[model samples]
Target: MDRFESLAERRIREAMERGDFDDLPLAGQPLDFSDVDDPQWWIKRWMEREQIDTAALAPMVIQLRREADGFPDALRRFDREDDVRAYLEDYNHRVKQDRVESRFSRESRIIAPVVDVEVTVVRWRELG
Candidate 1:
């Protein structure tokens, strides 16, 4: 190992021999995780600890994407097929026409199931 790491390890060993590490919190116990593994696990753990609402701080584009993804589910409030079709067409038109630094493309929107209002809306509701 590197010199710094070797030195730190030696110090820790010395402390352990001196019983300086005994009686510490959660000693000899595996960490208890109430959540799944994630790339931003620290953020999730911190949010759970502090009761933070991460969604409130999410970017508008991210929020918009979530809303768009669940558009069919939200359209469950509508009881008419025409309303569902109209809403889907409007959303598809918006996504197709959006020019956000070229990050979004017509092809991307074109390939997404969320944009296919008729089949998605009907199928999603029927599955419910």
Candidate 2:
């Protein structure tokens, strides 16, 4: 897993938290992407459901490409389930840390639009 996969996992967790799939249409359907594992299908589905902005999600495809490219070669060599599981645990932790650091940096910006708006309002009222 890499940035996009981590982000996608976060998005999925958020969606789950919001009960977005309580009565999911595909709940009982046996859907498998192994035969047709195109990432476009995921994007198309999200677009059709209006879950995310298509334009914003366009960059995620690039992230997915990076993720696919950076997938651990050790996992490919693993023949046992336990080995795969251990590799996934470490990979997941690394991805989680990357996602957290990325989010922290984004949040740390002092000039964020929302923060600027609040500050402007407070200063305006103070000057009045």
Give the alpha carbon lDDT tens digit for every residue of 37-110 in model 1: 66778887888889998887864445556768776678887787778788778776655444343365433432
lDDT of 2 by residue, 15-72 (tens): 9899987997778888766635775786677677786655455333344335434444
Candidate 2 regions with alpha-carbon error over 4 angstroms: 1-65, 68-74, 107-128
| C-alpha lDDT values of all predictions | 0.68, 0.51
Error of 1 at 16 (Å): 63
TM-score of 2: 0.27
lDDT accuracy of residue 2 in candidate 1 = 54
Clashes of each: 0, 0
Best by lDDT: 1
> Superposing every Cα of model 2 onto the true structure, what RMSD results?
25.3
Residue 100, candidate 2: C-alpha displacement in angstroms:
1.3
Q: Given candidate 2, what's the lDDT at residue 110? A: 23
